[model samples]
Target chain A: MKRIILALAASSILTAGAASAETLKVCAEGAYPPFSKTNEAGDLEGFDIDIANAICDEIGVTCELQATEWDGIIPALLEKKCDAIIASMSITEERKKAIDFSEKYYNTPARFVARSDADFTIDEDGLADMVVGVQRGSVHQDFMEKTFPEVELQLYGTQDEVYLDLQSGRLDAAIQDSIAADDGFLKTDAGDGFAFIGGNQNDPAIHGEGAGIGVRKEDVFLKYALSAAIAALRENGTYKEINDKYFEFDIY
Target chain B: MRFELALQHWEVFASGVWMTLHLTALCLLIGGCIAIPVAFAMLRGGVSGWLATGYVYLFRGTPLLVQLYLVYYGLSQFDFIRETWFWRPPAYLRSACIEDLMGWKVCAADFIPSLRSAWWCALITFSLNSGAYVGEILRGALKNTPKGELEAATALGLTDKQVRRRIHIPSAFRRALPQYGNEVIFMMHGSAIMSVITLQDILGVGRWLRAKYYVPYEGIVASAILYLVITYLLVFAFQLIERRYLRHLNIKAPGAERGWFGRSAV
Candidate 1:
């Protein structure tokens, strides 16, 4: 009985310590490189990680990064597995119905990547029966489904898998974030023959107001805090520093 | 549990159900066909038997998910497979091979297209995995065939092939029906992994729904209910088949009527 009471007292003390420490658990996709990725040392690095850390620092909280798969990232946040999603999640209306988003930190248009030698126009007629790959549950999938209903769409769990299928000639083309496609695939050795096919696809209705940190609907305080942090980072040149480290061009 | 979300997206779930059903049916049909020869070979007890045993052991020894990943992802990694093996023919051949047949543009060159498609990869992997399991079940049933029946057939001057075909295989099939039914249901459940390779089977739709709405339980609960319905239907089918074929194996109740064919009606 005495030992049990002692254990309960110790658990209460741990809980109190946890409540006192202001740690913001941010979920990011480790598979998405340049934005966020796990290095050879198993540490999470990249633009998303840096931005998330900066936001936590501005909010006077310790940032804890959790690597999550893209497919279940939103659900993870809703389940309170993490406090926020700093993954490159587009602020679309459909997603807004499920979770609230901070102001956009970065915005890039979607683009289609295809083999360089493949001669095809980027239109409904050109891709009528072609199989186009997109990451499952992404805005790109919604855009493709709405824009080209006749085309066969193959959904992959990750952008990397879409690139893999594209490389193997299974996919006629793939739709993804332009910068992601450029850095993650087209710039790599495995993407030797592939090149961006279409022009920027920034349909406001589908691609939304650009990528933002996703927070729960009821976490209004956190959302505002994140939006303010993003603005502060931009003003202090911190955002530019992270952007320059990842890309040559302005991505803000 | 926002089940309303599942109800609202019934069409998506229906499509997922359709994919799962077709995949399961194709795998079972192809797997059952492969199992027969493999079972016979195993019974024959030669080098062929060893080969059959090895095939079964290899597939059954590993998880179905690993086998699926190997086929779907691993196979596409090889340039030879992507470029040549089972790939579409050259442009010249492709154009020349095109012929209209009953309003459908049929191209002979397109017959052996690459195996990189998710449907093809899933079908091939699931079929092979199902075949290994069904083969082992059939082999076990064949081995357990009564020695007296084989001897009786031999005494009647029936050829080895005749006795094996007429009596040996049929009896074993009847005995194997119950176990094979279970294998069918197992294959259906195992097919949920199709989602991993991006084929929108039942579980895939569920995952998609969860990802879309961020409602964790609705999609999963909906999927679970659909699986339960499928399993119930499968159980009913197996029961009907068992009643028709294996009724003779059941002990007769008092005053039960025997059918005209010398089988109990009950």
Candidate 2:
């Protein structure tokens, strides 16, 4: 009986694995608004989610979005919790060592957001002894840690918490993607007093090529498929539509 | 198992261990101190006792994670707490306060704790939570003190204050020591939650490593081993303490020899 049950289970697992090929499970950080966020109706929405759907459409696969925490998004993919990660994960050299990435889906520079009334230059010396918040394990964290070591870095689990501390005055400034800070934060009522502090901080060595779809390093075919789908979306005007829905300026 | 990955980041793990140790130690010390007065107040039975009961109920009833979040994030939402309650001391005075304090940067913060800081928030939350548990343990121990001992003290013309100070409290502490040891271990384990608030405790380092490297279980497994070693040490220390302090309570064989250091050679 046990042998039969085990055989049945194995068959079921094999069938599920076969079915998964047609349904691309994509992991996204739902807390990062404008990029990805869960709406009041409990549906995941935003640019990343839309982009993931468009990519899946281009690839002729069903898109299944899985909301995951920012910290464990990559691990979730590596662990097979999802087949791919469509989160706004910057394609850093450090990350490339762990996972494979598609071609650039969208590229945006990191920026610092501070209170509109705050007086400080966006420089290493100017940020001396100031408390700056950034999402933990993010390219922005790497940038701040490497560039402005004088600044006291407070890492939060989510970008929303960074904004929370920033608004509460616990943080003097926060570093994040420019579009995310603008649309998700600065444009909101909660960010009435905050404004972008500096110009685009596009340090490619640290920030990397841009946000890309991450897959397991061994999934070379999936990586190429995703890169091709991204290119198709860009050519077919679906990428522009999604970008327009989220931001006025081109994020691609 | 990616053990090499964890090994390569030994400094991070070491700092994590150091933070966990100090955080647990500080919380235990502060909580133990808070426990004494709370236990006494609960024993006395009045408004203070009522308040103590309420404090214990509130902290013990709710999850530590929620309490921590309330203290760390919830408190920051208030304007008063953000602006004035957590006022930073002047740089000169703060430096003066911690100038000779082993060069630890946090010494000044210890002297004047600010709720705005994650470290202070974590310390406050863990200490209060531990206090409630320890307070209840101490209360039970104090209540169970021998009636004969109290009568004997009274017969010897010992005053109430003297009885409590010299005999009652000391006896209660001795009785509470084993249970208190368990509380210390629990606090050490519970201190892992400090990582959620972004404090680099053992688990924080684990999560950070996992996130940074994308290796699923290596960092967590390393942290688990570290915790296991710390727990083993704690258990061994507690056994030694119990053997020394509670020798009379130990069951002995018919002809057990009294060994050196007060341990029985059974």
Specify the highest-DockQ model's number.
2
Candidate 2, which segments miss by more than 4 Å at Cα? Answer: A1-19, B95-110, B152-157, B253-266
TM-score of each: 0.88, 0.90
User: Model 2, residue A205: what's the lDDT?
Assistant: 89
Candidate 2 chain B has its poorest 10 consecutive residues by lDDT at B257-266
Worst 10 residues of 2 chain A by lDDT: A5-14
Tens-digit per-residue lDDT, B33-135, candidate 1: 9999999898888999999999999999999999998887788888787677464456665576545677777765545544766788888899999999999
Per-residue lDDT of model 2, residues A1-252, tens digit only: 323433343343235483354677788888898898899999999999999998777666688888988888888887888888998999999998888898989888889999999889988788986899999889998898788877888878999989988887779999999889988999999999899997889887899989999988766666776787777787888888998988888878
lDDT of candidate 2 over B1-266, digit per residue (tens): 68898999999999999999999999999998898899989999899999999999999999999999998788887877656536454565555654545764554535777877788899999999999999999999999988887777788898988888876877777779899999999999999999888799999999888877878888899999999999999999999887666665554732224532133211
Residue-by-residue lDDT tens digits, candidate 1, A1-252 = 323433343343235343234677788888777788789999999889999999877777778889987878898888878878999999999998889999999999899999999889899899986889998888998998899988999888888788878877889999999999999889999889899997999789999999999988876656777787888889989888889999999887
DockQ for model 1 equals: 0.58
Model 1 bad stretches (over 4 Å): A1-20, A40-43, B89-114, B253-266
